[model samples]
Target chain A: MTIRLFLILGLAAGMLVADPQPQPKLLRNGLGQPPHPQAMVIEKLRRMNPEERERVLRDMPAGRRQMFERRLEQWNRLDSGQKKKLEGSLESFRTLTPEQQQTVRGLFRKFSETMPEEKRGDGRRMLARLRNMEPDERKALLSSPRAKARFSDSERDLLAEMAEKLPD
Target chain B: MSPNTMSCPLQSGNADVLLSYCAHMLDEERTELIEQHVAMCAECFALAEEQKTVWAALDGWESEPISAGFDNALFARIAAAERSSAWEQWTAPVRQWLAGDIGWKPALSVGVACLTLVVGIYLQNPARPVAATPTVEIAAQELEQAERALEDMEMLRQLEPTADEEKRL
Candidate 1:
């Protein structure tokens, strides 16, 4: 009798410790892949009632909550396939080492925020081209006379850093 | 040997006569016949002796007497059971409904009410709300996701690393 009681208690405790929520059906296709925490939460919010959504956002500061909701609104506008690809990219970004992530983020900030607005368009175009080139080809392009004529030394450095560090 | 000296009752599959003799229920003539068979047949004598011992034990055995007020208590329990049975019969339909055995008409009414509630809710909540919404502690994990997404979105928008970055956040 005591053993039976202990067994039941153990099972109840196990259930309490286990994750209670079921995975969303939409994310089921990504089973065996690493967990997509962002996508999971988005899917959960998508299904929530107003009361539930309100409850979830109640603890967040008003400003942060507004910003998050705006970001989420934009996220919801994407088609399912596009959402999947975006989520995949986020997951890939998350898997990178902290230092690697920082490198990429720093490079991007330099490209977008520090660069002049007039040159930002050209920078994006050049980065786009560099993204598809082979490692040796990328080196050749960065050193080419055309690249030198088009971009400053600093812009070329940024492109070189991104081309080497960014994931395919 | 006499004509009454018969075959073994056990072999004949007629052990009831031996049982009867052991029980002292047989008439005098039948008892005398069984006794004659027992005296000559060692097997019957031994079985009769064992049977006699069992009967003697049974005769000495006494059953427990009924407690005082047993009849009253038993009748009271029966009456209580009958009263409960009537109450149960009266509530059986209610129990079934509570157990979700409700008919289609009531189920349809409930479903429609729930659907109306859901539709009312969906109508009130727009796809995007411009005003600030409340936050709670239960969404700590989800809150973390939002924070991380916001941070990542800022960085990702800067990089435009993906070929289709122009098309997405």
Candidate 2:
């Protein structure tokens, strides 16, 4: 009986080992290979200035430049979704008004001087929040009576003291 | 000498020459080795190609000229920061001294002031009796009774021990 029980246990272990559970498979490109380098090179070229693109082509050998051009051509043939994702980042550069850009630059300078090691994510989060708000909502929040009343008596006194130091 | 002896001397001499060449600091020999390896090895050749592509991409990146006001803005920020830091540096010691001195001053001053105020109030009261000799005699008797009671209780406590405590002894 003991021998029979041992054999049963061994058989169960063998079955467990032999019949492994299937793992979820990640979807692959139909070709089962990474995208061509020409596609990546073309995307990079689109973001570069004409002068920079000319400089790179001039610096490279004819064979390498031909390879790069081939890649650029392939990148132009990508679907709209892929193209839009790459192009969307370029909009970030254009969306800011000159004055707002100046303000952001000033904020970065202040951050560097006061806290050089500060995580960039903090500023990014604040900017994201600001960007997500409507202009009217932002203005209302800044000028609210609730904001003025939020200070304690001592804090209000401190603010008054600070305000007195400011130029009229 | 045998071929092994001759080869050993040659190998050691080559190694010495190679060491003196400083292959890492002087790139010529190292570059030759890398070129040879890349030409012979598919993996190394692929890496060399990738490196060329990365270098080309890096060369293509152009940073826009910093705005004309950038320097003025940066300097203003630095100056403001310096002023803030200077103020903090100047005030920190004063703050610490004030905190340490003020923390104890209230407790000490209030205690002394209260004592003085109590004494003044007691002296101003006309209804209070001035029988100091009789009061001192009564206080001495009360203190003696309290001391005797404490001694008697201590003695009784010492004599009484639980069964477990006795076992420990």
Candidate 3:
């Protein structure tokens, strides 16, 4: 009886300790890759012994390692939905017409650099909100005077088109 | 078999130690130490194996699902019980008064009514008459101001990051 009681308490205490742990939010844009995959791989490497870690390091050339590290940082900066969508649509993205690709690239550059630092959070939140809206509602918003005030007529129309392309 | 062993010490404090060691929840050295102890102590070996088996069995256990109404029924029961408990506590003084035969209910009701009447009369006192709608034009002007403010609030709700929009993200 005492053993059973102890076991129950032990399990309860163990569960309490674990229940609040933060789980990595999974990306769900149709890709099967885990959230923060690059970080997870790096964490696993940190857990390895010096010899095994060195062996893994030796397996990759310095140039490859540097490129991988840079790519890892870039991947880390992408939000989960973006990461998932990019992973799933890499081939399709590459196959896009040059003009389409250039437009997408220009939009990304504007988001990364042209957007003011203070409004970055608002920009991201607005993008996420716009993505979450229904296609019909987004179309209405695109035509609304509010959007026209903020974006040029051409820019507003382009954004309305991009709404269908981007994932929430 | 020994009830306790130095190797797999079944002390109250070390209750989690064996379980942690078996589950690989401990670091390498601690796990190795416990592993050696289990190998040396037959009691601990059996306990560890038993725990592993129990865990495996639990993993295989499929729970019987309840009906959709189960949660709603449970919540209703909880709400009813809470309401009854609060009611009982609130009326405890009355119950005590009844037990003592002091006629508390009538006295309490009369006191509450008197208090309500005083407050109501105080609020409706005509002495400092609430500026009864003055000349028709000023009343209309106030109504217009109110309408303008309402329109401004609606525009603000659309222009700014309102609560619902922020929460949607």
Q: Point to the candidate with the largest lDDT.
A: 1
Q: Give each model's whole-structure lDDT.
A: 0.70, 0.43, 0.54
lDDT (Cα, tens digit) per residue for candidate 2, span A1-168 = 344345445555544333322322332333465433323333345555656566545655777556556545544575666444333322342255666544544443443444323332332332233344665654454345753455334433332332222112
TM-score of every candidate relative to the true structure: 0.47, 0.19, 0.27
Reference contacts preserved by each model: 0.22, 0.00, 0.04
Backbone clash tally (model 1)? 7
Residue pairs with clashing backbones, model 2:
A38-A71
Per-candidate RMSD, Å:
15.3, 49.3, 34.0
Model 3, span A1-168: residue lDDT tens = 344345445555544433332323444335445533333343344344656545555545777555544544455565666444444444344456667756665565555455556544454455555666898898787778876766666555545555555433
Clashing pairs in 1: A57-B134, A57-B135, A58-B134, A58-B135, A58-B136, A59-B135, A59-B136
**Model 3 per-residue lDDT tens digits across residues B1-169:** 3323443467445768988876669997777778777887777788999999988898899999999899999999888767787778787665555455555457557556655555555455424323322112123333333333323222222223434456755
CAPRI tier of model 1: incorrect
The ten-residue window of minimal lDDT in model 2 chain A covers A159-168
TM-score (chain A only) for the predictions, listed in order:
0.71, 0.27, 0.40
